[model samples]
Target: MPRWFNTAGPCRADHHYMLPALRRLPEVLPLIGQESYFVLHAPRQVGKTTALRALAEELTASGRYAALHVSCEEGEAAGDDFAEAQRAILSRIRRSAEIYLPAELHPPPFPPSPDISLLGTALAAWARVCPRPLVLFFDEIDALRGQSLLNVLRQLRSGYSDRPTAFPASVVLCGLRDVRDYKVTTDSRGHLGTSSPFNIKVESLTLRNFTRDEVEELYQQHTHDTGQVFLPEAIDRAFYWTQGQPWLVNALARQMVEKLVPDRGQALTAAHVDAAKEILLRRQDTHLDSLAERLREPRVRRILEPLLAGLALGEVPADDLRFVQDLGLVRLAPAGGLEVANPLYREVIPRVLANTAFASLPPQSITWLRADGRLDTERLMEAFLAFWRQHGQPLLGTAPYHEIAPHLVLMAFLHRVANGGGTLEREYAIGTGRMDLCLRHGPDTLALELKVWRDGEKDPLEDGLVQLDGYLAGLGLDSGWLVIFDRRTGQPPIAERTRAVAATTSTGRRVTVVRA
Candidate 1:
């Protein structure tokens, strides 16, 4: 295969991609007959459409099922016009079938208009005429809006019973969100939020990112085809940076192969992957741009602020959760908790928000302590308290990322200190209450947890002490400092709130205080 550098799916010249989802077809194929309506949702560009398309093609080739891939995105603009939307769907089905299927598998007639009743009629006609079972893979099902969405689902539900010989045996709805997250309504008078056309879904299936082993295998495929081996650290960097997001994984590799090392003669190392990450982030490519774009939404801000402070969101509405998850900003873990969906996302968010922070820091001025090395908690806190005494009020109120502003600024300071020599790893997502930042400077590690307290709380002193103790205890460290930002406090003089290092907690552990 030749080298591929353009945007889009696997190109003909370079088709070395071996997606694990495709390899698991044997497992997924049998489930289709048993499950009437299945859903496959994930963050954008994770190969949800590609995987289903491949499945549909394989099923059609088996001579047992006549599979068709139809996109609902084009018709979604119809809003509440169910009939027009249905016609659009049918037209897409006709076109897709013609393109993918052999010329002998003649296309069906797509009527000019299809109401709920006519949709069933048209589907039944196809099922009755076709020799094999009908399977419809509805791509971008979530794109359908208002009643157009409701009409399609209800039509599918109505025709579901007429299976095997009369209608599609199985239907797969693939999009950025699960079927359960779909909000459909038909109020031509106005718009609808949650009140109109509530939840109506059977179950949902989420497409997962490539696992660590799968990531390694995917990288090896590139090496096998191109002979540009990825060093162990490079593999680790790729997995850590992308968390195996399909497009990111491929794109990162492509950047390293074509842009970073066009000759393809040099071995790609972890540093190379790191360099590629810097380039991608600096350029702010479409993938990263789209992810960052949603941050402006109030819903996104509401959920993300608490998260950046290292707090857990108590209870969130299903819609908001689905919205964030769909954006690929976060994901629900197998352990039933929420986390940033992948590392690429985790790294990109802060970078986009604070571009000058890391770049301006002088790498040579900072020093990292080893594992046995100790940090002057009291001194650091004292310095910050002094700094806060002067600039705290003005900066806090003026911060762009208002909710998590303090945390972001604090991180900026530490990032400046640890610039060239240390690592800053963070875990904060929309809906996750607090942000947990782990800063490793050579051997010594500082775990700083941030929280935004509500009004009437002059001192979250009690709560802050308790949480910091727990965080320190988790790391089996008897010492660490906790910085609390009283968002409720009016901008007061920094001198009035200067730094104090007091041994506060039941353990008599020293906790440095920087009141900003």
Candidate 2:
């Protein structure tokens, strides 16, 4: 009876609050009209399927083409068995046609022949008999791999000439990547050989996430439907956290409207959005969990290690960077270089990197909390010193990205602080040679800066003091912590060398410098 935000599957206008699918992907219909095949790609859960299905329905409804959307995902299980994959794909086409098209427009049953050519042959048979020109969309095209994928592509390439009558007038291959990237893992025996399959594609289009204005418009739908409103600040905070990520945009709103504050009488506020973020991050729902899982990938670590440590990137491969970008983990900043795509990802990445150390951390003692729940920074420092002396070295060894072991360990300890009723936020840029952290508990705020000392580098203390001073200036504080980790060879043992001393910045701000 009421529409809601959808996070799990394709959005339906009747049941879900959604923008016009065609508006997000306006290039599709014109491409189809030109009888051109193309590729549409974006990361998982970004509304790829919903846009394709919506366009297909509109085209079929217009009586211009017998449009049908089908998925090649079912063929993934066939692996190198291209014939089996072909059968699975063809079966789906017939089923989709029967359910969505009139009998006169539905595809005919498959021919007796079954092999790598079966997909091409079956589509040709359907096209020849259907009264209207057919347009097809093959969703999850990248899910097919090895020889199976190669054959599917080759068959499509083979069918390119017989169009508008002998075959579907237009074809779209939709997935998480450009088909050209598929060559990386494809079986060499049946190599795709330089765009032979999808080379007919005139263009490649990507569906973008909603803009801030789009997000506002989407939330306004709730106001129209139920007489409830999302306050302006709530809308702003939600966009800032999600960065217009489709699943996150819908998921965060769903969390507030469905679970956090179900009452339509109460106006949603920024606090509700913040609470929803904490729940989403803590629960590590399927979407976030899948994102965290990407951290284990070696390519991911290669990019993130230097990012966390605020050091320059090395000779990383372009394809690897593109692949990570395609996965929506990082984006090229307007100023250049790369950054984690959104603030939420920026937080999740480091926490996930440090999860191992957090697990092995000793149970937290309440000594770090003041009577009124404010953080006792001095007490927390004492606890950290004792903990670092005993466990920091071993915990450093457990860091998933070794280059930023110290950063991860410190984050792990701070995470323990956050769990005890507070929040810890991180900020760093490649080549900054330092990471800044902000910890808040009730009314108390603590700022921390981390630096690594190595064999050839100058003493980072002066630079760290300056950086920490600037950080303090931003938070309007007079004092904060600057931690320097000695990672050079032949250094004194960590337990023996660890200590904290007071220092001053060039600007006369006070700093507590810890050397380990």
Candidate 3:
């Protein structure tokens, strides 16, 4: 069968182009061999289940152990009902064992036990009767909630002593988060807080996104299969854009080959890769939508708001930071601070944050273009000034994120300007004190910097000019716009203050400074 990129569930070798699963997280096998209990965590759809399942099959096939993969997701429906959750989980284990194991290695029936301790007793019973040592990969273990999650972790810890004989030799809890972040809401017990319930775990590991070389290697599998080639620049573009996010890597290839250019004779180029990225962003596929959904979370908002506006991240909880990282929303940058995990996220965050305002907007009336269909920066500025004078205040209330409301409104308007034919790119970071934008519309490119002049603060016009001067330099442009939103008390209404004027920066750059 022809192999293809996989964007859905676990990658099956028979159906998908894939790298060796165990190779991604090499520590897994050694820990299993040491009879260690650990946590395997990564963002959703990053192949945690696929890797763990492949390892289990490999261990069983090697004749060293009887191993199985199962999910605790089914048990989620039982809520805090520990007995029901255990029954659901144990049933999955028995079913998997029957399918994946030889008859002798299959679990003996789950023994009767109390509701609270059923999982521990059941595992002990399975290990006692099976001829070979058992290894368990508990996927989506975080899905269990409240007392249910706490009970399961306790049960695993309780059975930690009798490895390879009375209990499973190794157990791995797999989920989108480490065990500590599974803050289940229960009536009796408060949050999980910093302490993980599964304290017996020796190590917590994560499946990493593919490296640049692996990205090329995986794409090479496609060329070898279809006799089509992904050009070198195209491969570089993929890595540059996705930064090796597994689902995105596959999804980009899948969308390009499957829809954009179906011909096997054509070589995919950087342009094709760029088109694929735009399509993925505009279509808002399941994986990207799931990520955007997290923007609604308060903890997620707390970190991202300042990051989006290019300001300091105020006092945030450590676990909240870890939680956001675990969700794959952000990562530590090469220069040493946090950044949105990749370019895809950087685009999605603002667009998703401004969704309500974007939807609330009526059709844009300004032509915003020359007769030749090229973007006119002057006309675009005029349109923004006119629109802000009339609709900006009302639209601010439409945005869900209060801290970055001005940022979201402008992004929403820019989304309209760059809607069909071009792209608007955003750049912001901690302590930058402004958000920078690069809008590409046909042959024209416009650079913009946004700053807020809040109450009790001096004007940001000078700071915005300096900041925008640096931004335009990076883009290698001679000119740009510096926008200072006057949000201070006793300022004139937005209609009265919204105006644009040209100014020169310290770097001798022509800047359109808009104080609105």
Top model number, lDDT? 3
- Give one digit per residue, the lDDT tens place, for model 1 in 110-164: 4344366657778877887787778888888878887788777777777777886
Tens-place lDDT digits, model 3, residues 34-121: 9999988999888888898899899999999998999889999999888999999999988888888899898777778888998899
Clashing pairs in 2: none
lDDT values, one for every candidate: 0.67, 0.86, 0.87
lDDT of 2 by residue, 62-137 (tens): 9889999999989998888989989899888888888988888977777867565898888899889988888999
Which candidate tops TM-score?
3
Model 3, which residues run further than 4 Å from truth? 186-190
Worst 10 residues of 3 by lDDT: 186-195
Deviation in Å, model 3, residue 232 alpha carbon: 1.4
Worst 10 residues of 2 by lDDT: 184-193
Instruction: Flag regions of model 1 displaced more than 4 Å.
Output: 3-7, 10-16, 24-27, 111-118, 185-203, 296-302, 322-327, 332-337, 352-402, 409-484, 490-514
